[model samples]
Target chain A: MLIEAAHKPHERLGAYLKDEMAAVNALISQRMASKNAPRIPEVTAHLVDAGGKRLRPMLTLAAAKLCGYRGPYHIHLAATVEFIHTATLLHDDVVDESGQRRGRPTANLLWDNKSSVLVGDYLFSRSFQLMVETGNLRVLDILANASATIAEGEVLQLTAAQDLATDEAIYLQVVRGKTAALFSAATEVGGVIAGAGEAQVKALFGYGDALGVSFQIVDDLLDFTGGDAIGKNIGDDFRERKLTLPLIKAIAKADAEERAFWTRTIEKGRQQDGDLDHALALMHQHGALEDTRADAMVWADKAKAALAVLPDDPIRDMLHDIADYVVARIS
Target chain B: MLIEAAHKPHERLGAYLKDEMAAVNALISQRMASKNAPRIPEVTAHLVDAGGKRLRPMLTLAAAKLCGYRGPYHIHLAATVEFIHTATLLHDDVVDESGQRRGRPTANLLWDNKSSVLVGDYLFSRSFQLMVETGNLRVLDILANASATIAEGEVLQLTAAQDLATDEAIYLQVVRGKTAALFSAATEVGGVIAGAGEAQVKALFGYGDALGVSFQIVDDLLDFTGGDAIGKNIGDDFRERKLTLPLIKAIAKADAEERAFWTRTIEKGRQQDGDLDHALALMHQHGALEDTRADAMVWADKAKAALAVLPDDPIRDMLHDIADYVVARIS
Candidate 1:
């Protein structure tokens, strides 16, 4: 029901969000336009213009309005969240040695790793400065914790990657750290800076966290069972040897032959040309992709459940729709 | 006169400091010891155990007592300062791609760059958690500003390195950002959390800033004139193509041939063996090292002047001696 309303009535919500986010974007462009360092703007704009969905900032704005926030600090807090997100992306590309991001050459690849690392540090410093301008110690506490969690999640993922023993519990931790932490913090701080009550704040945080977890699970599952080649490639995780939910489930369900195949391809990270087809077949045989999708829908339902405490509003319906869109790509 | 106190009868500040710093070190060691991740302690303690005077934490302790602080937060602040310092060093080594740090293999070399970067992030997060536990917003502001300044300083240093046109002003900016920002913040927070008056906090910041400036100048000067490998390698800055004080000062006073030598060797990073002697001779010929020493003394005197507002105490006298010790190697 929420999904149907979101699809039909969300155009108005989108328009309102576009204007709200434009202000945040304008502030970011203004702050990022460093006169002293010409190279900073050049590199920072390269990543900023790469066009993320601006989901985090939008969450901040949405949560702020939902809680009856009347102050202007939410805009600043939203911008702060966006900066931290961008800074982490810059650093993440370098850490992951990722050559392409958003289907464009990453800053690390286009420039040098040195510039990426240093400029990321500059953005981080700038983000903190922006947060300080808000004069909210609670906001700082939230953002700082989010940053630490993001970093810990990254370290955990790094260690967990390629390890055969990584189970769903560790997988969940990594996904939460890598994705949910920022999402929850973004929405949580929106409520906090708005001076929302504890229940509203906690509701918003739960909504963001469940939505984040669902989003990541869908992304992971889409790598296996995406209906179209344009939507998701087959066995991207296998080639990278990333132990995602589908693969972990398949491994648990694998017979001797399938186990041997995974041991050769996944553990060794030496997949052959036809390995993608073989992996997909194995996943289908075990119904692992379907299971992962079910898990994601469960989280989406949990996300929708979190809004029970909030007053009925169009933005709340849009939030539910966004969670559906996250899983709809799998269909 | 403060330099002479090193040889004269006085309070046992160094021995007393050793005991105080031991407590700080114990706290750092305890925090760094990760149960699930043994690599955390291994990498952190490697650098923590590497011998340095723990000068930053010592400044925090000394400044706290000088401002009549008797609280337990000083210990936390001291440990927080050191954690920040160590985190920066870990990242700096990765950025510089340096092999040796304080005569030991760098964290990057010892445990790989990924480990160094992630572990550095861990320490940064730990430092934030420690400061948050203090529950002092002012102290948090002081430290968060310092973190930004430190990162910015590193970026400035990176940009300024290898640019021969970098002047004394730029060099001072780099030095202030990279080295002195933390020093001032460390002491400023010490006085602040101790509930010192505004004037006292300002004085403490001034003391730390001056001492930091003198300390960096002495470090630069020692790279040119320190004998017997007792100091870091002569012209290590030159080898790295870093535009340190002596090099910038020498360039200012250089004749055409000397300038050409710098352009080819330092700027181009094309120095061969025996260039160290030639470079040292050029420094002497232009009185660049001597000029740098003059700058150090100016900062030292300024540091002593900062103590003028403080009540006369043995700690104040010892503070003066410490500033003197920073440049003592050059003398």
Candidate 2:
């Protein structure tokens, strides 16, 4: 349906990629139908069917197709990626003790923590069983590595939370581990499972890694940018004492007054009603948001450049467009 | 060591196997050493050094040696198995909200729930990375399945707790998933990594499964029969409403009043002072403990028979002695 919108002026790549993503979503839903635990389907469907972007799974499916896969197993691979993603979200909600996700009530809040944890474990098991049925040990290796990396990332993020010494290097490591690893793995496995050559597989992973970095940087940037329609409020990262790119930059550029304010608000994690506005003003005054956006654009450009080695196809064009779409919102 | 005290009567098998199992203990301690995350080495040493029969890891090492594995990776595998077991204990303590393990404060109570959960996750990741370094896909597959089965078993046990209708069938499934799966995977992968034949692998798995089942049954029996020096007061499983072998057998043999007692104590999960004594008396009067001991002996015998299929060696003798050791108290 959004393909029609893609033809319009200033239309985004998501509009063009809607149908393929919907196929991935449908596949995910079908595979998530559990027989033993009735609660599993209910809880999993609640998160899976929630109207968030199926970006990761779509990336997996798109990568496989771009590598000239004609088999139906890509559907299973996409579903597996989505299941692992959804399961992580369920556990994350419990771990973060957060009430909202993707602008909706989190699973732990809606159901209970026990259900979130147990159901998350169940989905993980189900995901493994699904991958095992593929009989592709390489895929198993990739996905299991991704699962372990994702869990480690969450643990790192937990440890890094509210710690002011969390510099750019550790921050990048946290982001790469938490977000980029799965993205890279998803696309890389897609290429591997589709029987792509080593070079193309490497390119796909590079593209995915760059795209994921761009996506996360843009997301982090939006927290300070104050875009109401995008569900990002002003200084959200600062309010949470999350040392995003802009904040780290701003901290480096802090004047005496700014340093004092940041030390009290960000470092001490003590914020007031006007603290968000103050933080946003500091970020703008220091040009940190602009710097973060520029960094994101650099990654987006790298993602597009990685496609130079691949053979031309509509999927390649779409991937390039998707990379641009990642940074488009920040601009 | 208890080997010296318990082996006084059986001078032959006891002292020799004691030295062998001591090697297993030394291997476990050596492998559990960590350079990162000081808490890891600390929390792990707390449990690994806690006095218990190193039966499971010994089974793994013995199986590997019996299959002529000269490689040092078996030590890593043995430690990996123990780490997984310890990690699960940490998470299980939090989930069960238990206060005591080995008559000492649980990690949850001692360290905190957060430490328990995150440390459990850390050990899990470490184990995954360790197995990956093994570069044996079959070993990875076996261990991954064991992990899922272990989690599923824990969930199943959580659901089955205090549910009186949880009969021997579901009980056995839980036991298989929780205990036998890991035990079998430990021994099975030992044979696998050693490049043993399929028949040998299957026999090792069978031996471990029977050994684990018998060991768990004896543990449950000890909860009812063993005195405080063993070390808790009797009927710990009854107090916890765990529908173990003894309880399952007693539920079957129970009459109307006995059924009512179980319904109130286990199904309703209500217990008063002296209820443990009453439960033990019922277990005696109904011959439930006797039946559970018989079932455990049958499994021990089956384990010995499974070992009979393997080639005769000192490890084989130790395997047989381990099986005998499992039910030695009950017999």
Candidate 3:
């Protein structure tokens, strides 16, 4: 496991697709430039230049290349996906009132929320312009629907915040909104743009959807167990009262006293210093973390299984490896 | 002017297009709903229900109908325009740090800036979905370009704020971003969806663009003169340090002492009680407001002249009146 961790599947994928990824980076820099508003580029460069792992755009390039896409528009689609992701991150920081991201001061902190909001809108518009340049209405439709899903999921998550009634269904919905919709769209558009068969497109979409769900589940779990791996302190989600997978699972199993504790800490935002440890203990008592990990493994497996209908290629193997790597983080 | 103001041309346009506008409203209300995110509807309804002039959507409907379009998609186009307008307004309130809009507490104030930003994005995505329903790439292209222009104009406005160097050219660019881009997009998409001739579409775009410029010039002029008619206090722009047309024109003609006052009051934002009056006096002394009015008249005339290429319909006449009525607000 240690040897495997030294060179992750995603890193391997990135190295394999290095040339294509560079094109996406070039396109992102080119499109993010605002000829008049220097601040637009400034704010964008602050975030886009931040080490975002480029996982989402890599998913696009991989999906297209895996499906034998040879056109220039995979670059366009890859850049479009990154813009949407970056734009969302900008707004998410403002929405979450975050101070730092990826070990750097957030654009909202360095600049202000106003610049973040306006620049985010600019990037989204630029994404729209990029997609429209493809002139593929079906691609447009898939992306448009995905955009709506993402926004709806965000709104759903906001309204559900701190409500003890948030269950697995709501958790899944929020998960999809926060991550999966874009992943699925990134892959689906790649296949559609490549003129792949409907079955292959569906497989790609399914692969991305399950992979995103698994990725986020691992993120949530790592918040409790992986210490510094999640990029911050353990129990940040607990402090923020996000009812992610493990918490929801544990809460579903809570007894009367345990329910009271959750209500006090999460529902009322009255988190005490030792509360995270207590929550972790309760999750263990209920095996909630184990259950959540189990669920994530299932999703990772589903993601791998979804790719079975696609062509046999090294890109396909890397995508399969990415799915395996997602669950492997928490394994 | 008093006789003409008894029933505004916009009111006439609304009356003539009432049924179609009703359809637009219904579509807006229906699409603004979220199955999962109730806050979206809450924030949207707050601004969407605020007694906005509904002028932008009406431009779309009028343009399409005047071009002899009888399809149901015009309703979609009109609703798309409104969603874009509402979304921009929500973000604008956040950007301006505004407390109230149209005498109602803004969405950002009523709920929070987080909800405002997310809901605004939801509405934007919703607008994209609605435009895609038309299955017209040209319409999408026009709206996408306009969206970019609007965001760019806004970023430009942000960077240009309180800078005495902002000229009439920059002011016009900002005006186009803040108001005219959407206006022109609203009209242009309407014509495009109707499959109108290129000449007619160009005329429609020209009309909306000029009218929006005229409307905003009147709005800026009113901020200096029309106490409360703009739904806020006079000199609000002055207090906000916005360099509108009148201010830009007056700044160019400022004497040494007047430049000091302008610098201290606007650039430094160190306005005293009598600063607004001094600013107004300076504007009058230089005929700044008069020149701005002259500029508004030219755009209004241009708006009217653009309609000359269109078929002679009552909708066109009312559109012409809407232009005349805009300048009449300040004349």
Candidate 4:
């Protein structure tokens, strides 16, 4: 394999679509700037500059390119997706009252929650304006529907947290909203904007949806698996009392003694030291980690399979590899 | 005057559009609900049931009726405007950390800020979905731009507060964002969806814009005028350090000692028991309240003037009446 191709799937895709990605970056900067509220650009530039691989925008660019798109509006749509993503992060930080994100202080921490909330609203408006500039009613419809689903999912997650009754179905719904809604919309709109056939759009949507699910599942697994490379401390989820898939599975199969332990720690949120070891042991004994990993593999496979109907280009190949790489880190 | 015409303009318009307003209310209740997140509806219900004038949604119905529209989408657009307004209220409560709105506890106060933020987001998305269903890109464009303006105006308000330098222009911008943008969008979309002529749509926009600014300026004047009838305590704005038109005018004409007093109380926020009374006295001494009330009249007249191009129906007459009633409370 060529050395260039051996880099991570996103990196390779980033290298291949360097110019388009650069255009996306430029559009993000230009759009995030405000003529009136300097606080807007101040808060946004902090998050935008903290850079989370630009994965969502790249998904938009890659999907558009895969369908032979050469339009300028893809850049707008790409930036639009990023703005929505950034807006969500700002609000999420405020909702979580998080102090750090991507190894830096969160916007909510740097400014007050008021700035975070108001700036998030401004970014959402900016994203709406950008997508409207495309003048594609279909694109607008897709994004509008996705936004509802995403927000609904956030609310679901907020209510579902630390609840023992939350099942796998609720978990899937939350994952789709909090993570996958924008991902699927990001890619699906790219194909639609390119005037691709309905089948191609469906395939793009499937690819993005599956990839997003797999990405989130792997992320959840890493919280238990101890993601030192990613700098996420182990048991952070346990300490936060979040009900991830593995914990859900473990809770489902807990014996009376284990049930009491889960109740005190997960439900009651009275976590103690060394409880992390016991939780990990329970997850391992229940095969929750293995099942979650298997679930991730299944989704990654589904993502790769969805690409078969699309045009077979280098971008397509990168997209295919992206599925494997999304699961590869956990392996 | 007819008995109905003698009623408050909003109530008169509400009675006139009773059937359509019922439909709009039904749509709002239906859409604010969440199938998965019970918290969304729970929080939304607390606010939606608060029973404000529903003046914003009424504008949509009246504008559409005046334009001779008979479509089902007017109901949808009316509901959309209300959702956007409600969403703003939710977020505004969070930003203001306000305990009460429209004489009831705010959602952020009843629930937490997290619920306020997320539920507000859900409403915004639901509003987006409702508008997209209209299938009118022009309507979408108008609303999208309005959302951005409203949000940007909010950020401007956040930074402009407690600062003596916030001029009338800045106050107008903030008022437009927080109040006028949605009002104008509500009317403009109503006209556009009704297939009204461009001139009529422009007039509707102008009317909503001027009426909103007038309405807000009058609200500011009432704060210092001791609006006991409205249940708002005198000097609420003074305590909040909000740079309303009267405050801005007073600050603009302050002497050196008066400037020092403003710098101490308003900017430094070291307010005491007599500060509000003193603030009112200064406003009165400087003729700030009179000038502010005069400014409100100017905008209200402008709102009434913009109706010349529209059809001279009862709805049109009510809209004209509304511009007066908005300032009538202070007078």
Per-candidate TM-scores read 0.92, 0.85, 0.98, 0.97
lDDT of 2 at A265: 89
Q: How accurately is candidate 4 docked according to DockQ? A: 0.87
| Ranking according to lDDT, highest score first | 3, 4, 1, 2
Q: What residue pairs are clashing in model 2?
A: none
What CA root-mean-square deviation does each model show from the true structure? 3.0, 4.4, 1.5, 1.7
lDDT of 1 by residue, B1-331 (tens): 4556445212345465566677887889888775544567788889998857677888888888888887788888999999888988987877888888888889888777777777777788778767877778888878867876776677778777888899999888888887999999988988898898998899999999998999888888877776526426767788889999988888898889888888888778888888878988888887888889999999988988998888698888888787777666677
**lDDT score at residue B185, model 3, on the 0-100 scale:** 94
Q: lDDT (0-100) at residue B156 of candidate 4?
A: 98
Interface RMSD of 3: 0.7
| Docking class for candidate 2 | acceptable
lDDT string for model 3 (A70-179, tens) is 99998999999999999999999899987778878788999888899999999999999999999999999999999999999998988888999999999999999999
Question: How is the predicted docking of candidate 3 categorized under the CAPRI scheme?
Answer: high
Model 1 chain A weakest lDDT span, ten residues long: A1-10
Q: Write the per-residue lDDT of candidate 3 for residues B1-331, one digit (tens) a residue.
A: 4226558888988999999989999999999999798888888988888868899999999989888898899999999999999999989988899887988888888789888899999999999999999989999999999999999999999989989999999999999999999999999988988889999999999999999999899999999988436358889899999999999999999989989998999899999899998899989999999999999999999998999999998988888888888887776
Local lDDT at B72 for model 3: 91
Question: Per-residue lDDT tens digits of candidate 2, residues B195-280?
Answer: 99989999999998898888788888888888334437666678889999888888888899999999999988778888777888
Worst 10 residues of 1 chain B by lDDT: B5-14
What value does the lDDT take at residue B217 in candidate 4? 87
True contacts kept of each: 0.27, 0.10, 0.84, 0.88
CA lDDT for candidate 4: 0.90
Off by over 4 Å in 3: A1-3, A228-230, B1-3, B227-230
What is candidate 4's lDDT per residue for B1-331, written digit by digit as tens?
2324358878988998999999999999899887889999899888889878899989998998899998899999999999999999999988988778888888887789999999999999999999989989899899989999999999999999998989988998999999999989999999999999999999999999999999888888888886544547778888899999999999999999999999988899999888888888899999999999899999999999999999979888888888888877777
Candidate 1 global CA lDDT score: 0.81
Instruction: State the lDDT of candidate 4 residue by residue for A26-98, as single tens digits.
Output: 9889988988999999999898988888999999999988998988999999999999999999999889876
